[model samples]
Target: MITGSDFYHVMTAMVPLYVAMFLAYGSVKWWKIFTPDQCSGINRFVALFAVPLLSFHFISTNDPYAMNFHFIAADTLQKIIILVALAFWSNLTRRGSLDWTITLFSLSTLPNTLVMGIPLLKGMYGDASGTLMVQIVVLQCIIWYTLMLFMFEYRGAKLLISENRGGDMVMNNGHEGGGAGEKAAAAADGKAKIMPPTSVMTRLILIMVWRKLIRNPNTYSSLIGLIWSLVSFRWHVTMPAIIAKSISILSDAGLGMAMFSLGLFMALQPRIIACGKSTAAFAMGVRFFVGPAVMAAASIVVGLRGTLLHIAIVQAALPQGIVPFVFAKEYNVHPDILSTGVIFGMLIALPFTLVYYILLGL
Candidate 1:
């Protein structure tokens, strides 16, 4: 059970982040220290530099050989369940969309594991639970984040193709309807110029997504870190102090910078609930209820029981992750909703997580 001292430790971990966020918020909303462009630039820096290093640092330092396969399996299973459901909804339903698939996936599956999970779960479930949390972080950075980036790139490419096709149709229609013979000839030419096959177009989009993923630092940072972890563990090699210090300098600032970016985003918005009430409420439902419910089912399916199962469910109920919010703002995809998720998710996470802890302990 979480004691008063445990809660204090959780507070110690969280308070600094809130301080960074509020300082950024005050700078933007009250003092007007940064212009909109500057805020974007700061967020871009966090996305490109701080976050990648943070991912690398966490991944490289972990003892990959010591991973708990059962816990990892449970985590992977939960994400797969959500992904399959979202895929079906996107393909079959009129109300479903690619945008929501990406956003909802981030909202439901990706909790603030780095900032919130380690300290809180450690306090509740002992130091061993911290290892489980780190394993989740490594998996998240290496696989799921990369997949998220691919989805974003694919969606962007499809939108561009759609717009270009629309423009071409407009241009073709601009040609006046001339004589009957001329019109007949034009229609014949149009019919003869067939579009590429679906498979070919899909291959092209996949190629595009691959190229973008290659360029993304987050992609390689995690990969390189994983490779390093493997090499170091096998050979008993240690990273040099100088190199470690260089990485730690920036990576140590990562969570704080991310929170600052979130505050800047919130300050620039017209209100705290920037995505409005209904959307914010829906996001909360997914983050708290839907995410944990799915995770519980997955844990049971994967044969987790007792404290391990409880830890899995409680971690899922932590909060919305800040990294996804940063990506959303950088990609210009539903930033408002993500921002709301991060901001308000943090505000309510403590109580909600405690409630889960209590219920699961019972």
Candidate 2:
């Protein structure tokens, strides 16, 4: 029973909804209504708890009985193709290594499945759609996050080395130690100092992935939650119904507070917007339009319907995943360009994604 008008309505409503959340957070932040410690507390809560709980809840509800592994394969392949396509195009355009890698990273990564995808799906198809979003996210977590960790760590180390070398050269040679001529020489050497070798990056990425996978609180929380959900762990210790309602209310409010803190972090560093309009435009196009279009056609051709359709759209529509920015920030890739790509993807996908659901008659 869905129609184009429904699509437009849902899209319009949801965009403002998310924007309003951001605006509320921004206004409060600008007014200094919350202390830094309060904001940090929210971040910790969301990063460790609220988001993971949401993920677990979503996955638990979706039976995945009719799920198509082909859709998962298709989603993975499409992302890899887009990654290679952007990498090649960037190289052809001579967009430098850092920029090229970032272009690829932006095209392939997606936002947190829990925070962004589930809410957007729920708006389009209610609670059922939100559950499907979780399944798609689990597939993505397997491939995207694992690879992203590697990329972020390797690139970050290279940047650190480059910056340190540049600083030491300037300090040791600049002033009287070597005078102006020595400074010029050091500057030339600094210019020639390239990023570390690719194998080094590869190794660092593996190391980072291993470390995070084995010990990260976020990973552990998600894993435990999934196990609990799948195995049906619940306490018979009953509290008052009002208390349950109160807890849910508090958690929802906490989630909003956490998101606001993240928004503040994003807003304070406006330099992420400087990655050039073209990069942002290109990245957004790849993530939202090309990626989803490819997914839609592929899903139909491969006979993915119903729950699989639900799952596929969530993956197809999700903005650039947070893992990329996580890796980029941690490993120091083209953080500005990567961050800009991610932000652009999230903002644009917010409004246009409803059309995908309408196509599903949801």
Candidate 3:
């Protein structure tokens, strides 16, 4: 059971973030301090600068050599299960699409492990559980988040290619036809002439995605941090104070800025539940219920038992990660849903997580 001290610790870690969020919210909704353009700029800075540095700081500082393979395997398997399910849904179902897949994947698999999981799980499970949580955070920063970025870029590239191809078809048809019948014939011919083979188009999209991923700072931040971790751990070297301090300056603000950005997003929207009540409720269901259930199955499959298994499921029940919302807003893909997820997810995470803790403890 979580004691009063544990609750205090969690609140200490969380309350300041809420304070930052409400400040930003009041600035926009009540004070009218920041313009729409200014909010965009603030979000851009958080995404490009603070988030990358924060990722690097977490990745580089962790003791990479002390990995728990069982826990890591459980985490990896759960994500793989979610991915395969998403793939099936997208390929075989009429209701599925790339956008929903991306958003749902984020909603179901990624939790606010960095902000909420560490402190809260540490309170519930003990100090050893905190180490496990950090390992999860490091893996998230290195592998899963990078994969999410690639998917976002891939979807963007695919859409851009389709739009360009459609534009070319229109131009070709317009130039070659003088009447309705002729235009229909010309359009069919133009589509045949302009549209590349599916395999070829897929290759082109992959290339474009790679280029965009390369340009993204988050991509390099994780890679460089991992490389630094390997070298530092093997050689017993430490980052110099100046360099460390510089990173800490921005990295320290990452979660706060992310929350502030979330507040700004909420204030600008028509309502706090930006995606409507039904969708927000569905999102909460995925965040709290579906995530933990899937994680429980994955943990059992990976042979996790007792406290570790409980920790796995409970951590999965944590709030929606704020970073994914940042990515959604930046990429313009279902930002409303994501923003709603983060805002309401945080609000209800405590009671839901408490229930999980009591049940798992039983």
* Most TM-score-accurate candidate: 1
How much RMSD separates candidate 1 from the native structure?
6.0
lDDT of every predicted structure (CA atoms): 0.82, 0.58, 0.81
* Candidate 3 ranges with C-alpha deviation above 4 Å: 153-191, 330-332
For candidate 2, give the lDDT.
0.58
- Clash pairs, model 2 backbone: 109-321, 110-320, 110-321, 111-320, 111-321, 150-205, 152-331, 156-331
123-233, model 2: which lDDT tens digit per residue? 666665565566667765555666666555555555656675533433443443334324322444446643334454444446556867876555654565455445542
lDDT of 1 at 227: 95
Residue 299 C-alpha lDDT in model 3 = 96
After best superposition, candidate 1 residue 243: deviation in angstroms?
A: 1.0
Model 3, range 1-112, lDDT digits (tens) per residue? 6567766766665677778878999999999999999999998999799878877887787778988899999999999999999999998999999999999999999998
The C-alpha TM-scores of every prediction are: 0.85, 0.68, 0.84
lDDT of prediction 3: 0.81
Q: List the residue pairs that clash in candidate 1.
A: none
Backbone clashes per model, in order? Answer: 0, 8, 0
Residue 61 lDDT in candidate 2: 42
Query: In model 2, which runs have C-alpha deviations exceeding 4 angstroms?
Result: 1-20, 28-30, 35-38, 60-70, 83-99, 109-112, 154-205, 233-255, 305-315, 355-362
**By lDDT, is 2 or 3 better?**
3
Considering TM-score, which of the candidate structures 1 and 2 is the better prediction for this target? 1
